[model samples]
Target: NAGVTQTPKFRVLKTGQSMTLLCAQDMNHEYMYWYRQDPGMGLRLIHYSVGEGTTAKGEVPDGYNVSRLKKQNFLLGLESAAPSQTSVYFCASTEAGRAKNIQYFGAGTRLSVL
Candidate 1:
């Protein structure tokens, strides 16, 4: 994907509630990924897709799922919300054949679980 965009800039969910974060990219990219940033730790991968219609688990896949039915869109879904899941979520995409593998990131979605 080229330019990434994420919806729902901020959200607050009660325990057990669920929501889906939408990520869209303008250009067609082979690889797309989702990450979450906490206070101290660096970004942690939540899920990723190699191509359209293919998704793989990432470093922090628990409690989350991803879908890439279209080449320019990726969706991150939370089956249920928890306090530990509250964080700033980011979506990124990069061209697979590029040497630099430079990724374009979305503004981010801030989720707060109470």
Candidate 2:
């Protein structure tokens, strides 16, 4: 089973273009998250979903929107992309309320906005 999966592993966009990143997990996790890594910023959470249909904004959610329609899938959207928003986006998941369960990460999607 794929622990976590992200589509479109790499993308390039002109400023103001729109795109969506897709994430999926096969581990039946209840918690899913989206994070972006950039120079000096380390990693910052952009959005999360605690369960199917429940979503919330995270530390750097300003330019992103997320939806979780099924337990195994989470979608992140950039309505209007910008150069500053370019980064390596990662998706992670783990069983909810189990502190001992470590999150599993997908191979990140590298996005470049010009």
Candidate 3:
């Protein structure tokens, strides 16, 4: 079963272009999250969904939006990409309400906004 997969392993965008990154998981997890990893800082949460049809803003949700219409899929959209948005995007999922359980992450999507 594919644990987690992200579309477009790499992407380059202009300062104003927009794009949507797709994430999918087969684990039927009830919690899905989107995070960005910068040079030295740890992963910062962008958005998360507790379950299908439910979404919430995360630590760094500005300039981004998310949707979780399907139980296995979570999508992150950048309405206006900026150079500062250039970072490694990781999608993660975990079992519901199991804080002890570690999140399973996708390889990552490297985005560069020029």
Error of 2 at 47 (Å): 0.4
Could you give candidate 1's per-residue lDDT for residues 3-109 as a string of tens digits? Answer: 89999899999999999999999878889999999989999999999899999999999999899999999999998898999999999999987498788999999
Tens digit of per-residue lDDT, candidate 3, span 14-100: 999999999999998999999999999999999999999999999999999999999999999999999999999999999987469
Residue-pair clashes, model 3: 0
TM-score of each: 0.95, 0.97, 0.96
Candidate achieving higher lDDT, 1 or 3: 3
Which pairs of residues collide in model 2? none
Per-structure clash totals for the candidates: 1, 0, 0
CA lDDT scores, all candidates in order: 0.94, 0.95, 0.96
State the lDDT at 37 in candidate 2. 99
Query: What TM-score does prediction 2 earn?
Result: 0.97
- lDDT winner: 3
| Candidate 1 residue-wise lDDT at 87 | 98
What ordering of candidates by lDDT runs from best to worst? Answer: 3, 2, 1
**TM-score of the candidate numbered 1?**
0.95
Give per-model CA RMSD: 1.6, 0.8, 0.9
